[model samples]
Target: MVVLFLATSFFCVGQAAKDRFKDWAQTPPMGWNSWDCYGPTVQEHEVKANADYMASHLKDYGWDYVVVDIRWFVENTKRHGYNQIDPRYVLDAYGRYMPATNRFPSASDGSGFKALADYVHQKGLKFGIHIMRGIPTEAVKRKLPIKGTDGITADQVYTTENQCKWLKDNYTIVADKPGAQEYYDSIFELYAEWGVDFVKIDDLSAPIYHEDEINLIRKAIDKCGRPIVLSTSPGATPVTAGPHVSEHANMWRMVNDVWDHWRHLDHLIGVSQDWFSYIKPGTWPDCDMIPLGRLSIRGERGDDRMTSLTKDEQYTLMTFFTIFRSPLMFGGDLPSNDDFTLSLLTNKEVLKMHAESSQVRSLYYDEDKTAITSKNENEDWTYLALFNLSDSAPSDVWVNLSDMGMEGPVKISNMWTNEVLGTVKGKFTQNLAPHASGLYKIEKD
Candidate 1:
């Protein structure tokens, strides 16, 4: 059966043109992100501590990307109707964003980020940063100035119409313009100099729809002569622009900010049902981060916590995402993780399925339930995942391999517990806990 599945997947993609990004995401990309757990309030000290933990402990598992998320470069607050920049989100006089000098005393002037990025690389990991899609309006108004271009107003590069609605204003650039390319090129050159590896540009989804900007950013990265991966945020990218975005970006969000609530997952399963078929290499439909760990909510210390979810449900979410080979970005804090949460994150077998699964696709899903499978390129092994998404305790699930066109006994292993279920006939059966999922490996005899 594994061999058969391999043959089919190969046949489907063999004639297809090579996709640079798809090839990069065969097993999902694993990394740490600040948004889900930190929101817009992440500080340099917090980021440094997490980076240190990841380097010392999680680096061996391929958790390489250390991404510092939003509100990183706000210089002025007057334009946003505030007398000054939020004390929590202030950048220095230099246009670049760095850790607050007092909070992150190690990062003096532009020195901190370079040191952190260097530390991450020295520990055998990659460093990344996140930014909104448009030119920082504050940067524009204050004329803090761009790197290469001189005296160029932010309006000279972007249009007021392209501003993102939810966040403060960001003038969208017209990538097709010659000067526009220079503007982006300069920004990327600075990031390259800083040793940045991945960029997640947000707010490109709604108000200022800059489709060409995607191409421009790719061009800029290429011109910088670095292999930085570009990821877009905040929406299900339009199906019509699929091929275009796929050609440029390594990953794009398939849903808005996903939280630790079941309803968030509930809405995700509904909206992204059709998106599974589109989940191939390079252009991943990110489901956002896993928010199961410690979170700082509403100005309280680990207060504004996540919604109440059973351990089974949380694991079910993780299992489904793993089988999908989706990019796994943990949104929780490392130092504050509990035993159960740590167990989920450190499950080598489960993590391997996500990071090393060869083929990722939904075999079948219906009526608030799903059965997804992932196989390696050679078809020597396969992961068959069964999910029960209700609030009930447990449910029965029968899997049919007839469609795989196999007619022989096969060995199956329970991925989570590492317990082998022995050889079985072509048809398989199992019982799953409610809001739970099972990952099984099937092999032909």
Candidate 2:
């Protein structure tokens, strides 16, 4: 009888957690983030411009979610720069950071992000924001009151020892402290009231593995009475923590920031292999954002320019992310995207692989090449990607049909080119360019 009660209690807890976030992110999210292009200084007009572009051009292709990434509350952020010390961040009486009215004009008059969120919603897209994972250092120093609590203040729950190594703007919350959970709850409650659809919490995921804080945030999200997709960032997330993270977040980064560099792209192949088994319906092991087209305009990185990735490498990057079923967050400036980048972003067949494919696995990998395969849920279509990791001349990249559990005479269509390359048996091969890829859909002939 004791064992039976334990089993029932465990099942009830699991079901409740699952049910709470079930309606959020039914599949991997496809969206654009402001980080790579505008960095911490993205303004209201810039955000709306991107949303307008997505709604008018890319929404039909399943691209949505315009996320304002990082430090939207720091006043005079453009002049101070992102990582520099600034004493003028906008914060409320409860010590929670609020949008800087000068930057996000719509947030003036206590409106917060509601007006901007409504604008995004009207554009037929979802809105998201990036946040550091703890109480602002300024708040703790000022001993600001914790909302929804009688006597608790920010200092009571914050710990300097647990702060983010790279960013010192915030102090990590001590999960065991008296007002810790209340602080998280109050912030998420405000976010819910602001109609936030997604929140990407940074500095709390991966290497830190702040399980207690994560759970508190999860509880806060659940009690907020809204469906907000949670994404954790700056990964190299420990594979062993997959179960815990999957239970708490809709998406979690699998690598550190991914840029257009070939080395970064190559690194993702291995990261994807390690985390492939962790992916399920609602939770995704993110490969970070696709940094293509015009990037780093006003960002922390280098000067504004088109992506340094060659055209072939660009195709390979998209194919890799799509077949792996990673959440696609384009990091380029949308308005400045050229024809080639636009074509890549708007490909229906490639997006299909991201949305519908499952059971993705790396069939093989080496210094020169990598092969991955997946199948649609119905099992009617099979997707395969062969990447040339080498910088040597283009050569035959082949995958044996038997490895894919398929036998001969199959019709193959190149997803990128949308060209039907007649029936083949035993093995399929393509003469891919150096650092290029061939993505194909295979079917029994």
Candidate 3:
């Protein structure tokens, strides 16, 4: 009877936590993440540089979150390589990972990420960090005491049987154990104290789909008394689990790490189609980061270079994501953005399609062309994205007004070029370059 009472109380607390922060993430989050450019070795200076760039250039256009992705706790992570085998992760007494002072010097003197997060907040941006979905294996080995759980230790709450296939630094937490929830609670408490605004939990989403750990993390996020947006990573989050994920997380990835490849962009069409109905105001289906501008500077893929995607393909990438209302996280080196990339990222109309439009979905697709459409809630405009998926030739992409449930004689304007394409009745068509797209805004004439 006592155990049942405790379980009920815990459930109530979790519910309360979610209710308190329901207003967060009202729009798809736009931001920059460190992984695509710097991989596991992103340092304080690098993060600050991007934050500085965003504040100066991108902040006005709603690009705000600055996330430092994986392996921030390691001492000397090689460029393009995660230091999973290194037993030198920085951890607090209670077994929570801390930013390595060697990388984030501001975290020195037991301050954790408070100073860096404060700097980001001062610059009018939110701060986020990446974490693997488990207690550190090193902590369990040392039998560290789980904070907030009297006499319970790390090993007691961990199960070695469910380890991450790629990263061996942490052990999956046994959710039913006495100390498991307490440990997650403690880590989030520290994050709250440090003023973290977002957290991306890895190995808990698609492919692995650690639902139990996701719940524990959600509970911890709520109990911490902060409104941190919870994101789950490395997805293809099962379409069947959409409702469960929406209940627990603000955003969940719909595909694996999206990079500068045409095939990657092509795959997103089907992925978006499957997950379109699941998108809501606070919950989003993430398309992963946009790998444009200068990428792989010192990271996993290669040395510094502009995105391999052609200019037209880049537009298609942005068009697809915005129309689908997927969270946009710029994953390139910010300071190195060329005018073309800058224009793409800052186009207010395209951004509005993402932030204000609803009823977004693919209208039509074929062997050569694909078309998607959405309606703006705040305005009478309808957004249309026509893509030429063909590699060898330009293709004519068409959208019928009747299929869109709209009547004849519509005014259409190319969103990218800002050119009015003249009034059209019945249907509108645009010839797009190979591997390119045309985004148009349609209104009744």
Candidate 4:
């Protein structure tokens, strides 16, 4: 039966084919994630600090989620990579890892993340956590019982075959096994009770695609009776699996771990070209986290610093991310944002295009420049993005009005700088610095 279900493709037209969880994030989710700056070592106070900052300054701009990323259950975690210490994790009797109260004191006495989630809820924001794909290795090693199953154990429901090569935290759950589904159900149930609004399942889509496990998780969330938004990540999720992933997940990463480096930024543009066709209202092709503002306070990479991208490149970063319509998971210490970085986050016009635009597509590209175009579905206007990818020299970037579904005598206003360049008849042209970009709104005069 699992085989039959896995073989089914969820492709259909009309109302019923829409994902039930689609409404949970009609537009791509804008939020902060702890991974790029805090890695696996984010403390409760730090999480609360970011939440308070977001609630006060960013919630009105559509930034809502405050996500704790990776290994919140482990103690003595390293700033770079992980510390493989003896008896590293705190776990319950069921072999499921629990938050290390040393870091998240609010999780003490088996309360889990309830107190922290409640704090964020009271401040009018959502809470999310990151988890590895499978059952904890400690659980199987200790032979812990699987909840919601009669006389079934974690060891019985898992295998080591095809496990994550880099992260050795968990073993693969054998979905056909009697208690495997129950194990997934059990974890999500606990998360629901803890008031988790979002979940990012790591190592689920990359290197290898675990369709069975994803299906099991999808069912568990549905059965858990919460409107929990699911995000599957750490990929390059294969385009061949697009149909299944789009139907199953709210967002899936199209690239892995983008950081504050030019190479990483450039690679994102190249990689993102392949994913433009896959974006839809509910299912987003993630561009990973936006590595802006201050980062690496306790990260897996580099020392503490503000983002290295120059002002022009930062414009390029925000321009492509919004015009491409990727879920904006800002990766920085929120309270630490400088004025320029804060400006990037609060651009209402650019964000509006990100949320409401449809038919977004890559128009043309070459060694020096690329053009992207889209339309606002609700207000019925056109949007265009021009990017310069040269090494050092500025270049003139132009887009023909006809190619963007607009004719002559139309206004082309720069959405980022809010400058209207009067009316254009045949074409729009602007010279951009190397690695800079412009986002424009085009409408008939």
Global lDDT of each model? 0.69, 0.89, 0.89, 0.90
- Write the residue-wise lDDT of candidate 2 on 1-445 in tens digits: 9999999999999897765694588788999999998878889999999999999999999998999998998876652246565557889989999999988999998889999999999988999999999899989989999988889999898878768887678998999888999999999999999999999999877568888988999999999998999999888888888989998988998889898799999888877778878767888889999999998888867778899999999999999988888889999999998999999999989988888888898899888988999998586989999999999899788999999988868999999889999999998988888999999999889
Most TM-score-accurate candidate: 2
Q: What pairs collide in candidate 1?
A: 21-282, 22-281, 22-282, 393-434
List clashing residue pairs in candidate 4: none
For model 2, which pairs clash?
none
User: Which parts of model 1 are misplaced by more than 4 Å?
Assistant: 1-27, 75-103, 143-146, 206-209, 297-307
Candidate 1: Cα lDDT at 165:
65
Q: Pick the candidate with the highest lDDT.
A: 4
Clashes (backbone N, CA, C under 3 Å), per candidate, total 4, 0, 0, 0
**How does candidate 4 score on lDDT?**
0.90
- Candidate 1 versus truth, CA RMSD in Å, comes to 6.6
Candidate 2 error regions (>4 Å): 1-16, 79-83
In model 4, which range of ten residues has the least summed lDDT?
Answer: 9-18
Query: Which has the higher lDDT value, candidate number 2 or candidate number 4?
Result: 4
